[model samples]
Target: MKRINTLGAGCLARALAFSLAAGGLALPLSAQAADLPAAVAQDLYENGGVEHWLPKAEKGDIFAQYVLGHMYCNGKKVEKNYELGMRWYRKAADAGFAPSQLAVGTMYFQGQGVERDRDEALDWFTRAAEEGYARAQSNLAALYLGEKGVEPDYEKALHWYGKAAAQGHTVARYNLGMMYAHGLGLDEPDYVAAYGLLSPLVENGHRAADELMQSFLGEMDEEELVAARELSEELQAQDRMLVALDQRAANR
Candidate 1:
C-alpha cells in the first residue's frame, strides 16, 4: 500500500526521512505532553477556520505565516505559488520556528519550491532537531542511517531514534523496537524491549505496526511468545500509568 504521507510538507516529510533511514520499516511516536508548534497551529487556523485566519496569515503573524506558506505551497485556498510558499516559510523558519524550518527543509529535500539540495535539508533538519523537534530528530537519524547526506552510522540512527522515541513518536518507537528485535544496533537481541515498545502501538490500532510486530515475532518459539506476551502486559500497565500521568499533567 502507498503510505499515507502526513499532512503538510513538514511532518510528513520528516516521516519520509525516518522511513528512508529505517529502510522503509514502521516507526511509531511516543506520546508526550507538548504544545502544538506555531506552524501547526497556523495550519489549523487556515484549514480549520479559514475566514478568521486567512487575514492573519496574510499579515505576517508567524502562525498565519506558515498557514499562508502551506496555502501557497499546495495552492489550497490561493493561487499555487511555490515562490510565495517559499517566501513565507523562509520568513517563519528564519525566525527560528522549528516546523517552518522543517517545512522549508522538505522543500529543499524534494526540490518542491526550491532547488533540491541534500546539504540544505541537513541544515534544516539539524536546526529543528536541536530544538527537540521529534520528527526532525527522526529525519536526521534516517539520514545518518541511510548515508543520504552524511556517512552511514547505525549508532547515530539509534541516537536520533531515542530522541524521537522519548517524545512518544510512533515511528521512533517502532524503529527502536525493530532494532532490538533484530539485534541490529545493540549488542544482543532484546525481544523484551521490542515487545515493550511495540505492543502499545499494536493495541492502539496501528494495523501496519501490528502486522510488522507479528511478523517479527513469528520467529520466536512458544516460550518466547509467552515471554513477549508477559512483556506486553507489563508495557500495557505502564502505558496506562503514563496516560494517567498525562491526564494529571494536563489537568494541572
Candidate 2:
C-alpha cells in the first residue's frame, strides 16, 4: 500500500501505523504546539512506553495518557484492548489533548471500542481541528468531503484542507490539488490551481501527482502553464514557511 501522509487508517490516529510498523513505542507528534503543543507530545519518548506512561497517565498527565492509548490500541507493548485504549484516549482528550481527541474521534468513527456515531466523531474532530491539529484538520476535511451518512460540504472541506496543507500535511496537499483538478466543490476545475499544487509533487517524483499532472499538460494552454508555474513557486514558499514555523514551535 502507498504510504501517503494523513492518518493511514481512514484518517484516524495519526502515528498509530508508524509505531506499529516500526515495532516500537513513541508519542504522536502534533503540527502546532507552544511548549510543543496544546496537544499530546514529547515526554513519552524519554521515559519509555507502557510501563512508565501508565503511571503518568494515571496521575493525569495528558501526554502519557495519549501514548498509553496508542500502545493499547496497537498492541505495541500491552495486549490490544480497545476499551482500555479508548479510556486512555478519552482521559487525555478530556484534558484537551488534540491527538487523543483525534483518537477518540477515530474510535467513534470506526466503532472500534464504542458504538459508531458520525456526529460524535465530528464533534471530537472539530475540537482538535479547532485547536490547529493538522492531522485532525485533514481528517475533518475528508469528512466534509462526504463520508457515509454525512452531507458533503465543499467549502468546509476546503477550509480544513487548506489549514492542513499549509502546515505541510502531504495528504491534505494532494487532496487539495486533486480537488482543483476535478473541480470538487467548485464551479469549475482550476487547472492552474491543480498544477500549482501537483507540479512540485511531480518534481519530487510523487507518482500519483505525476499521473494527475500529466493529464493537465493536455488540458492547459501556455498562459495557464506560466501562471501555474508562478503559483507553484508561491505555494512552495508558503509550505517552507509553515514547516519552519512548526519546527520552531516544536523545538520550543
Candidate 3:
C-alpha cells in the first residue's frame, strides 16, 4: 500500500460526513469508517441515482450539478468525460457550492479536465478550505507539504491537517501522526501522541496507517508500546460505541 499521499480515502470520508451532516441525512455510523467506496455508492443512491439527477444537473440544480460532475469525472454510471465534467463542476462552483469549488480545483491541479495550474488550484482550494470544506483543508495540507506555489511550510501543513483531522479525516490524522513520529516542527517525536491519533484508523484496517504505526512503534520503548496498545484499545472501544449509538438511533 502506498504510504505517502494515499489520503484519498480519508478525504472522501470527511467530505461525505460533512455533506451528509450538513444535509441532515442520518448516517449509519456502523458503516466502516474506511469504506469510502461503499459510503459514496450509498450516498449516490440515496441522493437519487445518476439517471434521476443527471438531467437536473444540466438544469443547474447545484447538488445534482456537482454529483453529475463527479460522475463524469470518475466515470460513475457514465463514460468519463473530463471536459464535460469540468463544465459541470465549474457551473456549480461558480454558483458557490463549496464542494464543487474543491472538485474543480482538484481537476485543475491534476490536469484532469483542464490544464494543470497549481497556482490556480491553490487559489480555489484556499477559498473552499477557508470556508471549512474538509477535503479542501486536506488538499491544502498537501500543497503546503509539497511547497506548491509557496515555500515548504511544515507548520502550514500541520495547521491544515489539524483542521481536517478534527473532522475525523483519517489521512490528516495519519499525516499528523507522521509529523509527531518524525519530530517535525521542532517537536520531539511522541509515539504516544502518534498512537492516539492513528489507532482508530489502524483498527479499521487502514493498511497505510497500520504499516506506519508498526514502523514508528518499533522505535519506541517497551513502556511506550504498552501505552500505545492501551490507547488503541480505547479507540477501538470508542468506535464500537459509535456503532452502537448509530444502531440505537436508527431504531428510534
Top-lDDT candidate index: 2
Could you tell me every candidate's TM-score relative to the true structure? 0.66, 0.77, 0.62
Clashing pairs for predicted structure model 2, backbone only: 33-36, 33-37
Task: Order candidates by lDDT, high to low.
Answer: 2, 3, 1
Backbone clash pairs for candidate 3 read none
Tens-digit lDDT track of model 2 for 1-252: 211222123322221111111111233332222224432345434456677888888899887777778888877678889899899999989989887887788888778889998899889989989988877888788778775456989888877877888888777787777766666666566777778777777888878777666765777789878977877887887546345323422543
Winner by lDDT between candidate 3 and candidate 1: 3
TM-score of 2: 0.77
lDDT score at residue 120, model 1, on the 0-100 scale? 86
Better-scoring candidate (lDDT), 1 or 2: 2
Q: Model 3, 1-252: lDDT tens per residue?
A: 112333344442332212212111112322211223576556655664477887887777886777777777767678879898788888888888777777777777767878998788778788777877766787677667653455557777767776777766666667766665554542355666667667787778987677667766656778877876775554445334334323422543
Every candidate's lDDT: 0.62, 0.69, 0.63
